[model samples]
Target: MRSNRDRAILALAVSTAARASELLGLRGADLDWGDQLAQVRRKGSGAQQWLPASAESFVWLRLYLEDLGPLGPDAPVWWTLRRRERSGDVLERRPLTYDALRAVLRRANTALGTNWTMHDLRHTSALRMVRSQRLSLRDVQVVLGHAHLTTTQIYLVEDDQEILRRVHQYLADQAEPSQEAVASESTVGYDSNDLAVLLGGVPR
Candidate 1:
């Protein structure tokens, strides 16, 4: 059960794809616990995100802090359950650090056979936006805090699976046509000359 806590943390980190610094910078108070949305500051660009917390994370955090009672507004969000030191001696109260987070992720990868790095989590987040959510590049740029849309563009992956999915959808839609359905849809009719106007020349 305790091991699952560690696994859950690892899952959340990769799925969120937030920088270690940004993830560590999160505060408990930033969460709307009931709604599972959190306000986070991206590390380099300083952009803020309204990230949706995973249901598991929300539940775990609530249970972990239940005995500690309510936290202050500026309290450190992630706790080490120990003090920082040259040696890994435990401290009672201290904020979780990036170094510690790195160690946690390393263990998680070893256990799961998932060759993931800290930044790969961020990449995973970007991939999730593309695959699962089908978010626009513009939306990804805002969420990932890329300084330029070009930076975000590098992560756009159009894999064979996506091509197949699109092709299947196209074929399915083509196979299921009805005149009544077409009639109910709005039409933007174009003259044959529209193509020439668009191309700025006659078709070769």
Candidate 2:
């Protein structure tokens, strides 16, 4: 079973495409339940931007918040769970650090047998929005808060296999009309040599 923290990490990464530091910096006040938006601090500009939270992300976040119990607005959204030594098995809550987040991701990667960094999840989200969801590049740029369209273009690269499939489809479409024409003409007493000439070939 996945922990609340783990679920929140994955959901926010894929849904919001927020950087690790930005995500770690999130407080309870940043999430607006009614608006379905999370206010994140942009990296370079340090400007605050609002990102839409997906329904799936909202569900997971709500479950996590319930487990987290009531907290003040200034309290961190993601808290580090620490075991208490004095108390007979009580978990203490503290602000989750970047290092702690990395450790959590590392453990998750080991369990899943895949090497995925936080940024990888961001890229995956970008590609999914562009390719699978068929969203515009400008839309993705807004979601990712990219300053330039060129940066968003990097994420729009099509897969080689998909490109090849399209090429094959085009070639098949071009050949079909010519093949049908040749078949129809051949039924009118045209020999192989005449058919070859009709198809732009010199008779042998």
Candidate 3:
């Protein structure tokens, strides 16, 4: 994505797994740089919480904001790059709206030849967290703000393709002998009598 704003938005979405509305509602003051946490407004409850984000996301966010020049802490975090017509028949910098965000994704989907939506980003984030195994399901549940742990357990379901890959890898591993074992085995020639004894026959 050439648009730094879109890049920042995408980075934050996958890293934080925050709802689109939560991300859109972020103000310039919402970030805690020291902890690398972001304050996002949770959907439904309208409550706000801190979300841990990737450092790369912060890099993109800083770049996007730097391009916009200085903004007050209370200024909306996301803004339209192109000046838009506002009330009083004047063109002014406007906060990035949901429609504009959709347009951004539409353009990206067109260029990438993929049909994806903002909600997909949240799914992607959750899957990544679950598969990484660095975070527990409970942690993921908290991050996703699920009312019950069972909601996060949905990710525990194995994907068909992933199961296939793991099975193939295991079969391949089983088919091979450990090099250490092979190296430790005796390679000396055995006499015929010794071979017969080993084969459960009388030594002859």
* Highest lDDT scorer: 3
Estimate the lDDT of model 3.
Answer: 0.88
The list of candidate 1 runs beyond 4 A from truth reads: 1-8, 11-15, 67-69, 83-91, 132-134, 168-204
In the range 122-178, model 1's lDDT, one tens digit per residue, is: 787788786666678887787777779999888878889879999999999889987
Candidates ranked by TM-score, best first? Answer: 3, 2, 1
Q: What TM-scores do the predictions have? A: 0.69, 0.75, 0.80
RMSD of 3: 5.4
Residues 1-204, model 2: lDDT tens digits: 168777877888888888888888788899988988888899989899999878778788889888888977888888877888899689987888888878887887899998888999898888888886567889999989999999998987899998899899999988778877888887877687988889998887
TM-score-best of 1 and 3: 3
Estimate every model's Cα lDDT from 0 to 1.
Answer: 0.72, 0.85, 0.88
* Candidate 1: worst-modelled 10 consecutive residues by lDDT: 1-10
Off by over 4 Å in 3: 81-90, 177-204
Superior by lDDT: candidate 1 or candidate 2 = 2
Q: Which residue pairs come into collision in candidate 2? A: none
Cα displacement (angstroms), candidate 2, residue 1, comes to 6.9
Candidate 3 lDDT over residue span 3-70, tens digit each: 78889999999999998999999987898888888898899998889999999899898898889899
